[model samples]
Target: MGHWSRGEIERAFRDYSHAVVEIGRSSDWSRYADLFTEDAVYLEHVYGEMHGRERIREWITATMSVFPGSEMPFYRRSGTPSTTTEAGSSGRFSTA
Candidate 1:
């Protein structure tokens, strides 16, 4: 893996945020999946690991299907910083 500057990492996160918001609002997630490299690996604590962009796309699409629309906030609210921590604390996930 190559080293990335702090700015690059931050910009990537911002790009990821925008992509996620776009997917949530438009339900067109292919663009987000395209952000990943073909050989990218995605690991989720709950769903385990997936290799490659196609696999990640398939997993995310299926998992996100359980929730519809903005039931979960994928975008920033009132200019607040959008972080996974905030989303996780929003009480949107169900134990069911």
Candidate 2:
């Protein structure tokens, strides 16, 4: 693994947050696929595991189909990216 500088990590966080908000605002979960690399792997307890971006996109799109026209309201809590020096994850909150 390569070391990521603070700026790179912050930029990634901002971009990811933007993409997530876009998906929720548009109700097009497929766009979330763009956030991952072509060979990325996704694992979920309920959905099992998936490989590749397209597969993840398909799964998320299909699973999210149950909740149509749902808006995921995103909020930032606690630390901001600028102050974060280590790698971290972001989460989305949605009400279906």
Candidate 3:
């Protein structure tokens, strides 16, 4: 399989990263959940694991609720062109 162009891939990554972070900042669990695949699985090699969009929603909401008023987050007003893929893949987080 051929690789995607660097510019295209990097831009996608940047947009994806920004969206995910901003959702956390806003504590918008539903928006955050909408970004994931139906059966998404996010595994952190260092800490632990999270599976499914529902779980993702719950985790983000809980954390953001706990960290309210510390720092405000802002979505880029854009997002990656999702072609369908895992969002959080180690150093990268995306979907499309």
Alpha-carbon lDDT, every model: 0.64, 0.71, 0.60
Compose the digit string of candidate 3's lDDT tens values, residues 11-84: 87777666766654465666877888979997755536898989877876665467545332332234434432
Q: Each model's TM-score?
A: 0.58, 0.69, 0.53
Task: Flag the better candidate by TM-score, 2 or 3.
Answer: 2
| Cα lDDT for residue 61, candidate 3 | 65
Could you tell me the lDDT of residue 87 within candidate 3? 36
**Candidate with maximal lDDT:** 2
Which pairs clash (backbone N, Cα, C closer than 3 Å) in model 2?
Answer: none
- Distance from true location, Cα of 33 in model 3, Å: 2.8
lDDT of 1 by residue, 1-96 (tens): 569986787678766666665566676656667878999998888899899999988877777666775343553446434453334656342211
Model 3 spans with C-alpha error above 4 angstroms: 44-47, 70-96
**Where does candidate 2 have its weakest 10-residue lDDT segment?**
82-91
Q: Point out the higher-scoring one by TM-score: 1 or 3.
A: 1
Q: How many clashes does each candidate structure show, in the order listed?
A: 0, 0, 4
What ranking of all candidate models by lDDT puts the best one first? 2, 1, 3
